[model samples]
Target chain A: MRMDLDKQLNGSVQKAFLLLEAFTLDKPEWGVSELARSLGANKSTIYRLLATLEKLGVLQQNRRSEKYRLGLKLFELGHRVSIHQAVVHCTHPVLEEVARAIAETVHLAILEGTHIRYLDKVESPQGLKISTEIGSLRPAHCTGLGKMLLACADSEQQQAVLDATPLFAQTANTIVSAAALRRELAEIRERSFALDREEYEIGLICVAVPIFNQQGDLVAGLSASGPANRFREEALPHYVSILKRGAEKIREGIGNFQL
Target chain B: MRMDLDKQLNGSVQKAFLLLEAFTLDKPEWGVSELARSLGANKSTIYRLLATLEKLGVLQQNRRSEKYRLGLKLFELGHRVSIHQAVVHCTHPVLEEVARAIAETVHLAILEGTHIRYLDKVESPQGLKISTEIGSLRPAHCTGLGKMLLACADSEQQQAVLDATPLFAQTANTIVSAAALRRELAEIRERSFALDREEYEIGLICVAVPIFNQQGDLVAGLSASGPANRFREEALPHYVSILKRGAEKIREGIGNFQL
Candidate 1:
């Protein structure tokens, strides 16, 4: 069945992507044989694909290890994606401003399927107090940015996402139940802000606000995160105001853009 | 020749990359017919390729234009590159610190082929005074980062680069002769710093220093750029000190890593 699989499909490009998908942040490098075993493909086919990718510079082999990793060419092309040039370019400066004002790590993220993917970040001056990486994903039910984005989405989309995602709890503070999350989303929509009180990580806390484009469609979520001890209840209003200002600046800069 | 080309090559993956290569920043959007014409491929083949890529989230079609553009999946994969995770991760904060201290735009770049590719940047608080984008390439003969990197590379590599690259002038101050460039690079090596002197653009100037790993191998070049009017000769020592400190910080963090 697996042998017919390669022949049955209009293959080449699809096979290439499947190979690339095997490389991830958790396991960035792979030997040809390991990759072949993992993908359920023949070794010679995998070797040829790896050679082609390395030749194109989409992947590179470490001379010492002979293991392949994603290369700089993808980095170049990734930055060329129009959405990056059009959206992240404008929002990055604003993220910086918010990070400076809050003296905490700031993030711009959007919900993709059931996860929130960080699009950009400006780390705190005091050092990287947060572990979030650009282009990395976190579960939607526990992050402040995720809640803010999910809260602003239309009911149908929210329901679809909720139905699709399992809503597993990461910490005691996470609102894992669909009914509880629905109430929190409703409250977030009314308040125009969202907060994560040690939900995703034990000592991390975040506050977020929705960013909207000209059509009033929610474009992304802007958030400032810091250690739980530093997150004072009195500072909530200040954080919300600062995030809202940054969001408004982004909205003004990005014209009628969507994710 | 073109028809036979596909059969001659063990194609699929190569064809997909050739197709992806056409979606550059200068022309991010492409219609099926135009892409087919540009790449000298059959329309049906191009159409099928685009369809496959779109299905795999490698490309997205603009609703209004029906043209294809590189998608977020590429962005997601690009950021996972170990170079970005290992190198830029340490250098970006340092770039930000240098920009804050100097009150000018700062860059971290390295030689890729015969060109200098920007790896990270922090814009001046005054605004984006430098137009350099992260992951973008610029001629290695005109900018301060370029000269600094070239001056530090091995003699054989330097000669290979000089022999390969055409020393075309960008601004009137650009050194168009190989002999003149060699002299400048020698001076840069002797002085331990490099200056752009408005070589790349009429009104811009930059100062740069090389970063070395624990092994003392040249890693990257760190530079701060600003308008010529804002650049003062009296502040040269201060700028150099700041950039050197940032470069040292990067050097300590990267250990034995090379480009």
Candidate 2:
């Protein structure tokens, strides 16, 4: 009986999370019937779980639509996350410093699957700056941060990720061929920096360097992004130097922390 | 059997959330045995739930400590939260504008029980700015944002909250007594703003105004904080005016959103 209860509990927990996962930026609201249909779940089961989640403030029901959305409780739990504390808070000031010096947007990101998840960012004071939201994920192949981190990734990881994700071209500059992408990664590894010249988005450019821990394992990527016009070739060396310095500071601050 | 399974699933979901809640900022990491003891539950049940959560990446086991902590999955879900998209993303720019214009740290907050949850913040550019973190909860009685939001709350809510929570003093100036706090809130309601003169922290001073949505319901509180020395008596009216202006902008942006 005890074993049965434990299995049931675990099952419920998994189901609840699966339900929460259905609510995304693309579709933030989910009515029980539609959600159950999408997940191939029983409608009554979905309804019961929704009620339980709502009771804990994990899911909130919209008054007008009668649909469930991810609630502020998750927002609260996110803040409690140690990764944000360990990585974001420790390296944010460095990102801010780099942003101020470069007068451009700065980002700290870690490789997550085939994407780079933005952990923290400091916006450029300029009227026009790259405005990617924090906690957002972007394609690794077409981003400076993604490439820098991916370059540092193990061979198995790189091959597996590349295999799983298509290198869709965002612009004329995006590396479309896998062989060419591998060559670019090799070059990035050799040089210890990656550049995105209108690769992800037109008129946007980025330069990134890997942030290593004291133990010499790559933990994150630090990057500065701005309008392609303002990112002069002459400033590439300068950008790399400042970003490397910021990376070192993060290395010191991060200590032996793991993401 | 369906009804039985539904009951078990709901039970498990609630238990899992309760277990998750045990991992807080103050005590982020937890061992299965310790957690079970704290929750006063069966060790086997807690162990199973922990394993399930760890499998889903909702919690991660620290390699050295062998304790579970909130993980990247929660951080990812936090971003997917609609409140963050509806409120923080919408008002963050305005908070930044106010911070830049006032040269003081700016915050947007909502009353949560006897506390105020910081939804978004823009730090002051100066070297000596307030250092409260986003998603942190602070005593509402002592903060400008808290007091302003609390002032606008319905009387029953105010009474229930005051009755439930002890008005603990943080500093000499903090409103320690419920009567004094009620009077202060009443005055804030009359003036349509709130002030904190070293009430929470010795050197910190703040001014805040309530932000109302399009339907004229108070949704949030917007505040600016600076050093007590810098916050002059003569500048009170100006601060109130700027805060009110900022609140008006939030009203324009936040249509009919509820926290």
Candidate 3:
């Protein structure tokens, strides 16, 4: 078939990209032998691919360890992409203000297919800061920001995303059943906000409100997160009100940019 | 030679990555026909590679315009790399403090190959703000941060880098000569700081001091930048002292992280 021929032709390029994707926050650097074993490819082939990548400046090897890592070229490309994202740029000042006022970690994220891509974040100067990195992706079924964005999807699109995504429980409080998630999403839509009371991670609480653009479509979610002890159930109303105000300010900013 | 055969084999993969690298801050999106003509490749080949990249989530197609742009997955990867960079993470607070105190834009950067990679940046809250994105790369021959970092490299390393890089004149004040650059680097080494008197950009002045790790190796550069008119010559000593103190704080933070 034509599809089969196309796959065969693109196989080498795909494999090369797979090597780049193998590096992660947890396992950033990789030795040739280890990468070869993990990828189930011949050592010589991996070496050639890595060498070609290094020559292109898409990968770099440590001078002392000889282990390879993602090169600075990717950073250059990604930063350009970030600068162009209106959702990220428009929310930077608002996120900073919200974090400063509330003294909590604030985030701006958008749903990318079945995951949430964090566009920007501002951490509290308070000593117990959370270690969430911008550009990190998280499952769409477990986090407050993810659910807020998901709740905005149309029924057909929501069904398609739900069907394609595996609803893996990230924590004990995570909603694992399709029926349960649908009900929760419906409630979130009715309430115009979403909450994660230790759903994604224990001892953490978060509340998020959907950010809308000029056309009033969901563009991103503005979230405020902190330790559960400080983020008490009694304070939910106050936090949600602040988040809604912040979301309005972000929407105005987005409108001002005509984005 | 073996190198010739390797290049031949890796030709398709190289083409695929070239497309990825083609996206930039100015030309963030490209149509298939435009890309094909630019790369001098067949339309079918470019389309196939773009499709593969889209499927891998490293590139995305605009729904309305149908132009291709870098995807969120690349942002995820790059953000992870930024989080892992001790120079970037450790200097965030210091950069914010410096920017707030001096009422100027603060930047932290490291040398990447022949260029300087901006790891982090904080803008002055005042009405006049400089536009510099993190993860952006600039020529080392023009920036004060770049010169400070180049000053730390040994003669052979400096010569190797200089040989590979073209001394493109970014501004009228830029140094374009190898001998002149060598002399400038020597002075920077002796002074323990570098100054950019509108070399990189007209009407902008910058001062940078080197940042070192626990092992005392040059790891990064901390810079304070502002409009030339506001950054007076007599106040240079005071600005330098504040930046040095901030750099020491960052050094302590990096030491605490055991990075």
Candidate 4:
């Protein structure tokens, strides 16, 4: 009976995934038929998949609205993935060293879709705390780590991402034009570092450098962020030097990792 | 051709989920055939499902091992689940209040399978530093919060958990017998608190009380812990009173939540 049922349900996997994909940042929760219509699948199929996903803790059904939202299990799995000992094993000690040397918040971030997702952060002991959560996503065009990653991407891939996204202004200092962003990326590549001068948020300045794998391909970026007052223009050279050295150490550590 | 392909692939959803279920903590990564054999599904069915899951980042294929492991996508979704928010929202103020009052580390934990998973913690202002990761899990029946949760379970459920596992002695004060454990649970129920006298680790003492929901069901536990030197028997009542008050606050907070 089980085998027959499995065979009968075999082709609905893509539709099930499509239904899940329909619940995103803007549409966090959805009713059954709304999900079915969004995914272009039948209501019965959507209901069955939603029920199964809920049972597996992938989706949670709200008792009041009969709407479904992403479940806690996804968060549990995301935490495990982001903190996979491989990522933390390589980054934690290096981030600590960077924090101690720079006296700033050191962050490690990797590309997730069109956004840069922070994987780890180490705060400076003396300064005012700059609290940033792991797994939080920031736009890839307006942040230091994002610019550092963009600097490493091939021109075609960079163009593709740019074409797909709106260069929305986040702050008075944000580089909103495609031409300006292109020039910044070129400068970042030439200097081997990227800077965010209140681009994402006013008063925050970030300096970042890319960490490459053994194959010399960019894997992630390491960044040091602080108030504009603290990370002043005169301090850029020193911050750049320290961030590059930290990135190099992390790259070396990544090279030694088996996974 | 695309429509034909979609139609052909439409029935494979459940088979894919079953393949994912094959991977667990003990068998975190698995080869294609091993997954197929374990799930009692065909190798072809498993491969197709795996390929789909891999594209969605639900299952990651390790390049070197040629085995599949749970992917980072799940972690990303899990991180967004707001469980940590629930923990932080429910416990942060209570933890701060208790930590300040007793000058000891206060923790909130929930039962996950056979383990007690620490969801939130606040460190004391002075004395030896007690370190614990937010998502770290430790064996139930060993820690104070674990014991508090276990004490609430029915005898058959308690026996089922205790009987199926290896009771590794964490310290000299650890309890291993069913009869002795039942007696401890009885006392804990009567007193409305639980204690760990260096049971999980030497030189550490912990006191815990249950936190219930509006329905009066145990939802989680709150605890205060410190070095054995500071948490003497004479100080037990003070610790117990503060812990119970913290738990009460959490229960009230949970009850008052509108969403």
Clashes of each: 0, 0, 0, 18
Interface CA RMSD, all predictions: 2.1, 2.3, 2.6, 5.1
Residue B163 error, candidate 1, Å: 2.2
The parts of candidate 1 lying over 4 Å away from their true place are A1-10, A100-104, A124-129, A165-177, A197-204, A226-235, B1-10, B101-103, B125-128, B171-173, B201-204, B227-238
Q: Give the lDDT of residue B161 in candidate 3.
A: 62
What TM-score does model 1 achieve against the real structure?
0.88
- Over 4 Å off, model 3: A1-9, A82-85, A126-131, A161-166, A256-259, B1-9, B82-85, B126-131, B161-169, B256-259
Cα deviation of B1, candidate 1, in Å: 9.5
Residues A34-115 of candidate 4: C-alpha lDDT, one tens digit per residue: 8777666677767777877776667788998888988755554554452354676457768878888899999998876567
Which residue pairs of candidate 1 clash? none
Clashing pairs in 3: none
Model 4, B145-238: lDDT tens per residue? 8889888766765776578545667888888776777788889888889999899989888999998877787778888889988867888898
CA-based DockQ, model 2 = 0.54
Candidate 3, residues A150-172: lDDT per residue as tens digits? Answer: 89977775785578545787889
Q: Write candidate 3's Cα lDDT for B1-259 as tens digits.
A: 0112344347667777788878876688999999888877788888888888887778888899999888876777676663335556557878988988888999998876677888888888777787787777887779989898889866766786678545888899998888888899999999898999999999999999988866687778999989998988998888889898898888777874422
Residue A161 displacement (Å), model 3: 4.6
Positional deviation of residue B8's Cα in model 1 after best superposition, in angstroms = 8.6
Best by lDDT: 1
Q: Which candidate wins on DockQ?
A: 2
Error of 1 at B61 (Å): 1.7
Best of the two (1, 4) by DockQ: 1
Which of the predicted structures, 3 or 4, would earn the higher TM-score when compared with the native?
A: 3
Calculate candidate 4's fnat: 0.39
TM-score of chain B of each: 0.91, 0.82, 0.88, 0.69
Tens-digit per-residue lDDT, A64-85, candidate 1: 9999999888888788877678
**Candidate 1 lDDT over residue span B1-259, tens digit each:** 0633333334777888878889987788999999999888898889888888887778998899999999878888888888888898888888989999999999988897778988888889885477777888898888899989999988876786678545778999998788888999999999999999999999999999999999999989999999999999999999999999999998888999986
